[model samples]
Target: MNEKLLNNTACAMVAPGKGILAADESTGTIEKRFKSINIDNTEPNRQAYRDMLFTTAGAEAFISGAILFEETLFQSALDGTPFSKLLASKGVIPGIKVDKGAKPLAGAPGETVTEGLDGLRERLVKYREAGARFAKWRAVITIGNGIPSAYCIETNAHALARYAALCQEADVVPIVEPEVLMDADNTIEICEKVTSDTLQAVFDQLYLQRVLLEGMILKPNMVISGKKCPTQADVSTVAAATLRTLKHHVPSSVPGIAFLSGGQSDEVATAHLNAMNEMGGGPWALSFSYGRALQAPSLKAWGGKVDNVADAQRAFHHRAKMNSLASLGQYNDSLETVA
Candidate 1:
């Protein structure tokens, strides 16, 4: 299983001053993102957009790894270099998103379970051969009225553990993600409770499945208030709550926790992470594995224009650099105004 390789890769994914870039949006998902900018979601556009991000000068300084979708794994740069090869050349680990998507769970209203374990072992073999050293599987836990049932949490945790086992068996570090969605009107306390329970369940299943904790990175939602909540948490408050929940639930054996942006604005996400790092003292490294929070600015700058490539890349580099500084507790509002 190459345990050393898995552990080393997992550690590198959250190395000091670095984090993962979640460029693994599926076709449908990227389509929605592209639609927002009035860009046609064509193959060429997708390739170009990703190419821009990958080729951005100095991005490798902050981006330790890039999680790719299936198509992106095989796609090439404008110069014909494979995306995986391009990223590897820049000292970035290549990872794949293995989950099919979330589906409605029967008997659990307003809940979902992430699918795609049907042929994961075989797929992992293929992804490994294609230069992927890690993989991600996400399980969504919605917070709503009378929901996030025990059944739903258990079912998703079991799936995540199974997927992690498969990934480790194939020598691929797994990013086990159990996101407690922030789409509800719930308070920060409710978010904390849900995130804590979901993480505890995930670790329990990971133990039961015999997954190597050191060979996996946890991608969890930060303990924060819901979008519709009256009182949004301040940066320091969110950081403290997130660290408290993580320290209580996540085993120290795990190499790191790479937080999903969920629905946080780019600045807000970076601020929260910076606050956490400033507090320090966690057993494992804390970093980001953001999608929209990382990509939104770049996408807006690109705006489907060839002339905007440099601007898009600059925007991407700025965000990545901000998160990089945040990872080391060096970011501040002053840095935001620079350049």
Candidate 2:
């Protein structure tokens, strides 16, 4: 393992006032997003949309790095620059989503584990050669009655650890994400318990597989009430709960906790992150690794029209700046009303 390279990549990923841009949606995922905006999900459309985000002027100021889909990793920008080169030129490290989507676990109803280890080591070498310095694999854990069993968590944790170990071997940093989904009607306390258990399992596996703690970033969800929950926890409450859970479970040896926005609304995601930082953050740097929350507004603004490219970029820049301030505990709700 190239320890120095891994450590440097991890630190840059979670640098203060900056976070990761998860423009790494799979083809099927991007299709749904395109449908929402009444646009065709063509290759050109995908490339154009991503190109707009990557080439946004001054976006690198708040964006430390970006996680890319396989297609984007190999695509080129309008100016004929490879997407990875364009991002690096702007000082944003390029990364790739290495996991295939989560598949249902055997005999575990309502639970899924991420899979991509079949040939990840070889792929990592190619990805690195193509300018990807880091990789991401997300494991999905759902919350429901009699679900998220120990079997499910353990299986996913093992996979995550194996992936991390292989990544380091390939000299690529890994973003280990074990997301306890918030799609149910569960209460905040239940979310809390599940998130803690999931983190504990992930870390235990990381240790067992001998992955370097300082060489990876943790991308987990914040502890919050489920989408269908009758009562939702406020931003401050979610922030505190998330902090408490991470402190109790995650090791400080990890470089940072770059949170996934999960299913939160854009402003809500920004608010929760800001709240976490306001409360003095935690032992790890509290940053974001958001996909939809950072892209929804820009997608709407662009609507696949060339004339709206600048508008889309402005929307993206605004969200990036908001989350940047949140990373430093400097963002406020009032800024949302501007522009």
Candidate 3:
């Protein structure tokens, strides 16, 4: 493992005032996003959408890295430039999503684990050669009555650790993600317990596997109320709980904690992150690795129209800039209306 290179890349991923752009939606996932905008889900359209994002002016100022889908890793821009190269040319690191979608965990009803470890080393080599310096693998943990059992959590954590080890071995920084779904009516307390347990297991497995902690990033869900909860926790409450949970579990050796905006609205996600940074003095950098929270407005602005390319890019830049400020605890509501 090129320890120094891994540490550099991992730190760069969570650089102050910058974060990762998770453009790594699977084909099916992007198709659903396109469906909302009335755009065809053709390869060319997908390529065009990403091209607009990658080419957005001033994005490099806020976007340190972009996590790409397997297909997008090999895709090219409208002008025939490889997407990976385009990002690198602008000083953004390229990353790939290495895990296949989550699957049902055996004997564990209503829970799932992420797959795709088979042949992952080979795939990592190819991705690195293709200009990817990092990779992401997400494990889904559903919170419901009697769900997310120890078996389910351990299974996914084990998979995440193995994947991280492989990534470091192949010279790629792994973003270890174990997302606790916020789709239930659970309160913030429930989310916190699950998140805490999930993280503890993940880190324990990472240690057992001997994955270099400083060389990988932790992309985790912020402790917050569930989407269906009658009363949601406020920004400060969520931030404090998330910090407490992470501080209790994640080691200081990790370079940073890049949060996944799991089902959060764009503004709310930014607000939560801003609140966390406002508290200050954490073991690692608290940043973002958001997908919908970062791209929803841009997609709406684009609306799949060729003439809206400039509008889309503007919207993209605006969102990225807001999150960038949020990373530094300098964001406010007034900035939301500036553009």
Which parts of model 1 have CA positions greater than 4 angstroms off? none
**Per-residue accuracy of model 3 over 1-339 as CA lDDT, tens digit each:** 999999999999999899999999999999999999988999989999999999999999999999999999999999999999999999999999999989998899899989899999999999999999999999999999898899999999999999999999999999999999999999999999999999999999999999999999999999999999999999999999999999999999998999999989999999999999999938899899999999999999999888999998998999999999999999997899626
| lDDT of candidate 2 over 177-247, digit per residue (tens) | 99999999999999999999899999999999999999999999999999999999998899999999999
> Looking at candidate 1, what is the lDDT of residue 84?
98
Q: lDDT by residue for model 1 over 1-339, one digit each (tens)? A: 888888999999999999999999999999999999998999999999999999999999999999999999999999999999999999999999999999999988899999999999999999999999999999999998888999999999999999999999999999999999999899999999999899999999999999999999999999999999999889889999999999899899999989999989999999999999999939999999999998999899999998999998889999999999998999987787525
TM-score of each: 0.99, 0.99, 0.99
Candidate 1: lDDT of 316?
Answer: 92
Residue 227, model 1: lDDT of 96
Deviating ranges (above 4 Å) for candidate 3: none
Q: Which residue pairs overlap in candidate 1's backbone?
A: none
Best-first order by lDDT: 3, 2, 1
Q: lDDT of each model, Cα atoms only? A: 0.94, 0.94, 0.95
Task: Compare candidates 1 and 3 on lDDT and give the better one.
Answer: 3
Show the colliding residue pairs in model 3.
none
Model 1 residue 48 lDDT score:
94
Q: What is the lDDT of residue 105 in candidate 1?
A: 97
